[model samples]
Target: MKTLTLLMTMSLLLAFVWERVDMVRLGYRIERLKSDKVRLERERDELRVKVSSLTSPARIAKVATEKLGMVPPRQDQVVVVRLEPEAPSPTSLAEFEIKLAKHDVSRKVR
Candidate 1:
C-alpha cells in the first residue's frame, strides 16, 4: 500500500512540474508577442508620419516642379467649355438602348 501511495505522489509531482513548465513557456510567448506588438505600433507611427510628409501640398508641389518640370497654368491658358443638356429622358429600356448605341457610334467616329 505504501508503494502505491509513493507512486501516486510521484505522478502528482510530475504533473505539477509539467504544468509549471507549460505556464512558463506560455508566459514567454506572451512577452514576445507583447514586444512584437510594441515594435509594430512604433513602425505604424513612423509610416504615418512618412505618409503625412509625403502627401503635404508643399512636398507635392516641390516634387512636381523639380522632378516632373510641371508649371501652373496661366490665366490665358485656361479654357472652359459649358455643356448643354440636350437629351430628352427615355421612357423605355429600348429607347435608352437606342440612344446609348447612337452615342457610342458617335464617340467611335470621333
Candidate 2:
C-alpha cells in the first residue's frame, strides 16, 4: 500500500511539473505573437502612408508629365459626337428577325 501511494504521489508531481512547463511555453508563444502583431500593425500604417503619398493627385500629375510625357487635351482638339434617339421598331420575334435581315442587307451593300 505504501508503494502504491508513493507511485501515485510521484505521478501527480510529474503531471504538475509538466503542466507548469506547458504553461510557460504557451506564455512565450503569446508574447512572441503579441510582438509580431505590433510589428505588423506598424508596417501596415507605414504602407498606408506610402500608398496615400503615391496616390496623391500632385504625384500622379508629376509622374504623368515627367515620366509619361503626357499633356492635357486642348478644348479645340476635342470633338463630341451627339447620338439621337431612334424610333422603336418591331416588338414581335418575326418582325425583329425581318428588321435584322434588312439591316444586315443594308450593311453588306455599304
Candidate 3:
C-alpha cells in the first residue's frame, strides 16, 4: 500500500510539472502575439502617414495640372452668374438670375 501511494504521489507530481510546462508554452505564444501586434500597428501608422503625404494639397495640385492637363480659367472666358429666389410666378428674369448664380458658384469652386 505504501508503494502504491508513492506511485500515486509521483504521478501527481508529474501531472503538475506537465501543467506548468504547458502554461509556460502558452505564455511564450502570448508574448509573441503581443510583439506581432505591435509591429503591425507600427506598420499601419507608417502607411497612414505615407497616405496623408501623398494626398497633400501640393501633391494634388501638381497631379491635377501635370497629369490631368488642367489649367486655371481665363478672365475673358469667365462669366458671373447669380441665383434668384424662387417665386410663385416664375419669370425669365428670375430664371436668368438663378443660372448666373450657379455659374458663379461653379467658377469659384474650380
Candidate 4:
C-alpha cells in the first residue's frame, strides 16, 4: 500500500513539473511571436513610407526629366478629345418609328 501511494505521488509530481515546463516554453514562444510581430509591423511601415516617396509626383517628374529626358507637352501640342455616341440615321429612325412598339400575340383580344 505504501509503495503504491509513493508511486502515485511521484507521478503527480512529474505531471506538475511537466506542465510547468510546458508553460514556460509556451511563454517564451509567445514573447518571440510578439517581437516578430513588432519587427514586421515596423518593416511594413518603413516600406509604406518608401513606396509613397517612390511614387510621389515630384519624384516621378524629376526622374522623367532627368533620367529619361522627358519634357512637358506644350499647350499647343496638347489636345483634349471628347467622345460621343453616333446618332441614328434619319432612315433608321423612321423605320423604328414605323415599327412603334408592335409585339406578336397568340390571339386577338375581344
The global C-alpha lDDT for each of the candidates, from Candidate 1 onward, is 0.75, 0.75, 0.79, 0.77
Root-mean-square deviation (CA) per prediction: 10.2, 12.3, 8.8, 19.7
lDDT of 2: 0.75
Compare candidates 1 and 4 on lDDT and give the better one.
4
lDDT of 2 by residue, 36-67 (tens): 99999999999999999999999999988888
How many Å off is the CA of 42 in candidate 1? 0.7
What's the TM for model 1?
0.68
Measured with C-alpha atoms, the lDDT of residue 82 in candidate 3 is 68
> What lDDT is obtained when candidate 3 is compared to the true structure?
0.79
lDDT at 110, model 2? 10
Backbone clashes, candidate 1: 0
lDDT of 1 by residue, 2-64 (tens): 999999999999999999999999999999999999999999999999999999999999998
The TM-score between candidate 2 and the true structure equals 0.70
Please report the candidate that would top lDDT against the real structure.
3
Per-residue error for 22 in candidate 3, Å, reads 1.0
Lowest lDDT 10-residue stretch of candidate 3: 96-105
